[model samples]
Target: MSITRLSDLADKAACPRLVVKVGSSLLVGPEGVRRSWLGELVEELAAARARGQDVIVVSSGAIALGAARLGLEKGGRGSLADAQAAAAVGQIALSSLWAEFFGTQGYPAAQLLLTLEDLEDRRRYLNATATLTRLLDAGAVPVINENDSVATQEIRFGDNDRLAARVAQAARASAVLLLSDVDGLYDRDPRDPAARLLPLVEGVTPEIHAMASGTSGSGMGSGGMTSKLQAAQIAELAGISLAIINGTYATPIARALATGTGTLFLPRRKAAARKAWLGGRLRLKGTLRVDPGAEAALTRGSSLLAKGIVGVEGSFERGDPVAIAGAEGRIVAHGLAEYDSRECARIMGHHTSAHADLLGYAPRSAVVHRDQLVLK
Candidate 1:
């Protein structure tokens, strides 16, 4: 991987699809919403749109704004119920504010609330990706946030950093910009006089992770340098570059895209065609335990046949992503299922010729076509 400053970023032209994450600390304040800052941010977004790039904002502020509106204290002391309540109330306000700002610029805006499960579940993941693609194609900017109102500790993403990375993958974005209170990653905490900012990062190494302060934000946000590093790692795996910049800076988004003003973490390398889609990002809806014959066929680059599938585990839909396991229960591949769980169960151990008689309709011979399968 090559590391370069922001100066080189402008030369490559803006990415076709970009995901920008804005922290709660930058959008909210003790006095309420920061109108001036929001207006500036809107202008920046508009400029990007004018350049023909699709932009998605993964915003945080609902919980903080809701807490303030409900007269609750802003800190970790709040109960789970309290946090949920704040998110419920604040989401409306947050969405309204964003819609209003983008509306003024003549751009339509849509709200998307997601939980970790939404991205993990195969059906839901496809649905989310479809919605986002449709919205972008329709020239609408999507303002996404975690469904904090219903998210529990087990279901919550906790911070928007990782959520932004997931959004990038779902949207197939080329890059991600994380806007936070601090400018970028530093050799040490910026509070330390001896600390220096690292403007370009080729990869997130052990040394880089060590530099994280692991300190949460002062107000309503939960992200720290540690979370940003985690976000960078996710982006890297998805073949997306990520940048960390101080949201407080004037025109931060524009500056980051045009001049590389933030700390840019490059992807390790471009992902292989199959890995880009059915890789680790997708949640496995079920497992297909294939017989030794089928496993050998797969290894030889052949399509998966029903005769080779000895067992099917879990319930899933036809288009859902599932794990393909060998005789020993070790996952050897993953791909989009051509048949649903019930259909697979009925046809298991049978020849491909029996598919039409079993299901009363013939779609294809292979249970999973070679085109969709990605061997691990």
Candidate 2:
């Protein structure tokens, strides 16, 4: 839970499953796609795969690469239309390049473009996780990036760093690596030459934050040390370990996982696949009323029961997160409903033993199974 311990975990992570998010700055430097760096990344990823690790890459640079290829001198700085157009073209070319690169190495890479809505919506989020799981199981690497073209503000992933964190939570990855231009976070701007790199950040205290100056330059990339830290915070909350390191360095991805060097953010508490999935999103669909005793039991980490349910409101089927409301109509927890709205209403206020007779259905578990619940 302490950043002090992050490095040790980084060193020992053996991290059977990993997620690496690459920034645009690392992809297209002052020149073009840093072929050497890209090669090192690919080789390292391949090596990890060979070592029995499943890896997913959240890549940025479709727009940058597309604009460069299209000879668009003014890209993102230009009109929105130009930016979207560049992203569309770049996404196609960029994905093709990745497919070809990984294919030659005998590992296939699949491109997945997600908008912010995918993570905000619980069902859609699960679908995305399922898709990625299938890819990892099939021994294919999933390359995720924001859908820059079609996505507007509502569904946009503001930055790839944020997207990367969400992806880590979605996949329940034990570790999340953020590859950028900066080597690591420094107490002051490293450019001053007098600044110093803080090796271990146990927690982003007020003093530590004061040390974080302006956005550290990332050349063509939107994220800086500050943004990476924010991503780390988000990833950490869901129990995903995070690292920010220099992407240009040879084998940066694999090396960081090997604890070569980086700023590591440790997970406060690692959640299981189901808990991680449920806890990551708090959006509620409906409400479930519980008695005072039921509230106590559920809050104490006990499973839900029909005996606890006083009522059900709104419309949501099985597996949907519904707010667990107390007698006073205050929400105490959010959990996946075991039955549909009508079914839950019928089973409400009844004891668990009577589920089969009243509902004429052989219920397997409680009203809201503990595994499906996310306590507030």
Candidate 3:
């Protein structure tokens, strides 16, 4: 992997799809929601959308808003029930605020509350991906937040910074902007006079992780620099660039995109997280033997069509990882299967036009989409 660091942030030209994470400290306060700040932020996002960019916001303010409404302390030390109740109450207000603000800019905002479990389950992951894609295609901004009201301790992400990274992975975003309390990562405690911000991080290493200390935000927010570092690592591995910037000022997103006023974490590649996982980590549950024409098509970066599939082995369902073999049973690639084993058996050696007649319903055109395949 290339460890190429940058002295500045990657410009908007480099990121067509962006995820911006807003912390509670920036959105809520002792009184209530910071409407002016949120309005400004929405304006910046609207400018991005006008430029033909897909923008998603991962916001964290539900619990804080709820706590204030219920006369509870910020960053509650109460039982999980208290927090969940706060979340349940605050979620409506939070979503409403987002809708109200974005609506003023003539942008429709959609809410998506997800738990870590949703991303971990393969079927749900794909479904979430599809939903996000559809929302973006419809020219709406998705406002995502952790499902704090329903999440247990075991399933809770507890912080929006890491959640933003995971959301970037799911959305195939090109960059993630973590707009929090601090401007960027510092060499030491930011309170120290001698502390200096690191502008660009090529890779997240142990030494880099050591620089981050305890949480640095207001009591309303849960994540500290530690969670941000963890987020950077996640973004790096998934080939998505991430940046830490303070959103205390007006038009911070525009300034950061233009002037690189933050610490930017570079990705290992320009590829999406799905491709990276398919290429390396996932275990294969089955195999497909394809004809020589399909083997050549794969080498040329084409999708695997049913007409090229000669044999299917092992019992696997749709979205399961499977290996593709060519001549002499040599493995050529691995990918997520679009159809189950029985479906593959029925559709093998047939044209895509014949799929509906054989399967009783029209399915995906390719057995393995090029985006989901990793060539060996």
**Predicted structure with the largest TM-score when compared to the true one:** 1
Estimate, for each residue in 121-188, the C-alpha lDDT of model 1 and write its tens digit.
Answer: 65687788999999999999999999999999877888899899888888888788899887789899
Give all candidate RMSDs, comma-separated. 6.7, 7.1, 9.8
* Residue 145 in model 1: lDDT: 98
Return the TM-score for candidate 1, rounded to 2 decimals. 0.73
Each model's number of backbone clashes?
A: 2, 0, 1
Backbone clashes in model 3, listed as residue pairs? 215-224
Cα shift from native, residue 248, model 1 (Å): 1.1
Q: Lowest-lDDT window of 10 residues in candidate 2?
A: 1-10
What TM value does model 2 have? 0.70
Query: Model 1 shows how many backbone clashes?
Result: 2
Is candidate 1 or 2 superior in lDDT?
A: 1
- Tens-place lDDT digits, model 3, residues 188-295: 988899999998887777688899976655877778988898787667657888888879888777776566567888865444556654543224679999999999
Measured against the true structure, the TM-scores of the candidates, in listed sequence, are 0.73, 0.70, 0.71
Backbone clashes (count) for model 2: 0
